[model samples]
Target: MNSKPVTRIKKINMYKISIIGYGNLGFHLVNHLSETGHKITQVFTRDKTKTRISKNKIDFIDDLELLRTDADVYFLPVKDDALKEVAKQLSLKGKIVAHCSASVEMKVLKNCTENFGVFYPLQSFSREVEVDFKNIPILIEGVNKETSSVLNDIAASLSNEVIEVNQEQRLAVHVAAVFANNFSNYLFSVAEEILKKENISYKILLPLIEETVRKVKEHAPSKSQTGPAKREDDKTIQKHLKFLSNKKELKNLYTIITDQIKSKK
Candidate 1:
């Protein structure tokens, strides 16, 4: 056999990411990005002593003035109210700047850099809980095609569903998320409270909750609807309202939701 020369493939340097927040979303971003072989140049947080990465040294800065201009993408996962103020402090004139807020407009970063966009990930995050980013929907809204392409590439690396959406569409999805995730979680808490009062474990509702979600997954939520209100069982509804009479707040909530469901029927 004739000897052949070995040709090695050259590796390209990925985007240098700088995360501006250290909250739940920010924590996951750093973990996922670093794990995906992307270089995180720096992380801007109040706590420089705290580090999440074990393999590589990541620069942590508490001051906005210390933010390096070398990063190709700066992700602001800060609070929606403080986004503009934080964006105002950044001096990344030509670098790509994006936010992780679902409701906040992408134009909020216009003053921070010439290339700006939104990198809103549609998921509820908690620092202690591990989330798989493979199936998560990442909504990207860039100012131009260049910005959009860059964001889309980064998002695609982390998720299979990388959607390029406009500000209006993003806001609509955000609202729906609040209703689906936030509101439903709150209702679960209410269920826990109700069960606790009777010295019952909330775990008893777990199977029911799982079944409810399964039903919705298999059919339209409206079509999957059940319960006294949806079935026009006024006697059962009144009995439930009477039981919750002492809990004025719960009673009112129950009535309001019952009426809404009844109206739909």
Candidate 2:
């Protein structure tokens, strides 16, 4: 003991992070943060059946009672429905807690802790797909200046874009996301069904889909608009509507969407 000198622990830029949930977003945050030099001290999940933590040596806790509250930042990337319930179960006190829900505000975590924030990553996450967060926009909001700085540092370390957006702005962005992503995907599904009925592969529309997306990237979506609705072609519209006549919902959806599109033009 006398021969060996005491070595002090380095407290520079590194932060201890405790990630909650084991979903796609949670996996992304854990993997990306670990890759970017942040210390993931704990991983909390509901299901521990398929969880594998080989990249880093971290404490994995599935049970709520066993969750560690010692980390500098605790990330809650769980579903919106599970957020409040988890918050109720956990007693974080003064720890910095954050959630990834697009709709819910940071107030949801008030019961869990006095210091809380929203660490919303504004993009879809998939475990099977590799994500490059270099240019991804991470929306952040905090209960106070201290919480904001902590979240900002963590976000800035891994992402090229970091925005401090309030609840109203975040909700608007989320609604727009649903329109740009989910609604379009649903329309693609409908298109696929129509093509399948005619023994035509959906691959035929792939180029069209890609080009449409590209056009919006280059210019405004309103300016990039095309097709029957944009041109107000009643003949083509009626023809398409008649084809979907057998399905009442589909027909009504087609009419409503066409009307809305035409009105926009």
- Candidate 1 Cα deviation (angstroms), residue 92: 1.8
For candidate 2, lDDT tens digit of each residue in 27-60? 8888889998888988987777637643556678
Name every residue pair that clashes in candidate 2. none
Q: Please give the TM-score that candidate 2 achieves against the real structure.
A: 0.90
lDDT of each: 0.89, 0.87
lDDT of 1 by residue, 1-265 (tens): 7989989954434688999997889889988999888899888887655565434567788899888888899999999998989988987888889999988888888888889999999998987789999989999999988899889989988998999999899989988998998999999999999989999999999999999999998999989999999999999999999999899999999999999999997
Name the candidate that leads on lDDT: 1
lDDT value for model 1: 0.89
Model 2, stretches more than 4 Å misplaced? 1-12
